[model samples]
Target: MISTLTATHIQKSYSFEGIEQTVLSDINLTFTQGQLYAITGSSGSGKSTLLHLLGGVDTPTAGKILFNAVDINAMRQTERTMLRTKNIGFVFQFHYLIRELSVIENVALNAQISGINSTEAYDKASQLLDHVGLRQEKLKYPHQLSGGQQERVAVVRALINSPTFILADEPTGNLDAHNAQALMDLLLDCHKQWGPGIIIATHDAAISSRMTHVLNIKDGVIL
Candidate 1:
């Protein structure tokens, strides 16, 4: 069965020199399985913050992030890390590919770290790369690839384990229009063919319009 991830009564704050600043407040959202969701807002509107909290990379000042009815925030750090590795994937604005590793190695590294045999991991990664049209560049380093190619490799890394969902933060922000659309096309193909839910945080309406749900936020509250 596909998992349901929900954020309830979420709030995030940071203290700066004895002053409290809030990044998100009373935010509540439920992500259904196998659907595309877009969180739309200007920068600082808490889109990225929400993704971080949902992904278990950061804790909320208040509220619980529940996965299949269990509170993820209540998990031990190591447990949370394991859950993230096995069930959740993240794509950031930057590709964040390792400079030293070949493209195939970059995608397979997580699977190998999770205890899969190296040969099995590489075999699986090779299949994903071929599906994403990067088979020819598998042995190339990050510097040898273009920006779009680098980002595609990052997406492949996220999908290595076939996570239940992916949280993408401004994934297309750094790409040109053509490349941005191309990236989205690949994501859509994955969503349909592979059956993973996608939650994308973006400022572009054109991109947001394609999502099944578009959530507009301002000053940290959904509109």
Candidate 2:
């Protein structure tokens, strides 16, 4: 099977007060298309760091991250940005929606950035909103929606560009059980309908248990 993502001898570190701290070390893993992967670890165990590296939001200090066999770290900044915009989707713990923008506008923004025309972008966003059962909420602002509704909008935004993979970090951390389960069901439904790889960094056992692969991260290494 072809790998959607691959990490080889990956390392990430930060320097503070003239001391180097490693967040991840010599890590290696592969994520395949149409698969759901759960990355589980305690707080401060570099789960988010790994996700950022994979999504091209950050670069590793050493080694390589390959997306469809292309080395993202080796690409120029513009190239990497284009690659991310076209092929990677991100869902964070917080719904980072612009409060001023309407729900459909927020979701359409991603597609617009990827060069889709305004009418087409909004149409696609509207369809995605309907798919997530939020069609009526499209004209509402972020502040007007509930927490779960805001997150559902974020998911729609991430998927607007039809990415090859979705990298989610603690996506359900702030949600109640009912909303969390609902969100997970939507994610699984997306996986079934679309073939994008889903890689989630989560502490929720209920979420991890449902994934096709469960990886444990301890002290920056895959265990």
Candidate 3:
């Protein structure tokens, strides 16, 4: 399988009070197409930072992140943004849906941003919503749905563009056990069907155990 993402000697740090603190250090990793990976760590363990770097949301202090063999860290901001929008999907702990938009509309927003016509975007969103068992709630706004439902909508939105990689940060952190399990099941199902590489940062062992591989982050290094 082709490598979808690669991180080489990656390091990330932050400056506070004129002191530099390293969050991630000397990390090297690779994600292949159609693979499912879990990043596990305790609080403040740099899992989220690594995920952000991998998704092109942030740059590494040193080293390189490559998507489809192209260096992301070296790209201009606009170019990186376009690359992310075109090839990467993100799901966070919060649904981050627009309260005013309907469920289907929220999902369609991503497609629209990707330059898909509104009509086709809505059609595709509707299909994805249905696949996630949210067809009945298509017209409901985010504020009108339960937390679980909102997260489900977020997942569909992430997948609307059929991105090459899906990067999720504690996607189930806010859900109850039942809802969390359901969401994980949906993610796994999507992975099996669509074959997109998935890299999720999570603390839940149950979630990590189901992945194709699990890497633990400890004191700023992959273990």
Candidate 4:
């Protein structure tokens, strides 16, 4: 199978105290379908930066990112947005769900945005929520659910679009050990069933070891 995501000679930098500080330097990586990858680094190690670049949330200062051999850096903003909506799904350390919406509503929002009819989207969302084991919590608001339940809802939302790749940054960071393990298992199960490229940025060593492949990032370089 073809690589779902690739970053070639990527470099990123930002201004700090009026001076440019480099985060990543000459980084190169590729991820194929059905692979679960872990990217780990210290607080300022640029792991999240790399994830953002791969997800098209941020652009690299140098080098190119390709999704299925199409240069993402070259695409116009609108084109990139469309591609992201269709191909990439994201989960974060915090479950960024709408507080006002119920779990099912939050999950269905993405499908609805993708032009899926309301009834179809709701049906798909309900099924996904059930798959994530949040069916009973579907009517609950964000705050009404526990941390684990909210995170499950977030995963459902991410998967609702049936994206080709899933990018997660510290997805289980806020959970306890048991909850974290459960979340990891759920993520892996989804990857196994759908075969989307799953790339996660995390600081937990225990979780890192569970990945199929692991990349260590230090001073913005993969080690």
Candidate lDDT values, in order = 0.87, 0.88, 0.87, 0.85
Total colliding residue pairs, candidate 4: 0
Local accuracy of candidate 2 as per-residue lDDT tens digits, 1-223: 4447999999999999999999998999999888899999999999999999999888899989998888998899999888878789898668699888999999999899899999999999999899877979999999999887888888779888877899988888777888789888878877877788999999999999999899999988999
What are the per-residue Cα lDDT tens digits for candidate 4 across 38-147? Answer: 99888879988898899898989999999989999799998898777778888866778998898888988888888899999999999877766776888989999988
Q: Which structure among the candidates has the greatest lDDT? A: 2
The Cα error of candidate 2 at residue 218, in Å, is: 0.3
Winner on lDDT between 1 and 2 is 2
Cα-based lDDT at residue 25, candidate 4: 94
Residue 44, model 2: lDDT of: 91
Q: Across residues 1-223, which tens digit of lDDT does each residue of candidate 3 receive?
A: 4657999999999999999999998999989979999999899999889988998888899999998788997888899877777788888667689988888888898899899999999999998788767879999988888877887788888888878889988888777888788788878877877788999899999899899899999989999
Report clashes for each candidate as comma-separated counts. 0, 0, 0, 0
Candidate 2 global Cα RMSD: 1.9
Checking candidate 2 for backbone clashes, the offending pairs are none
What lDDT does candidate 2 reach at residue 116? 96
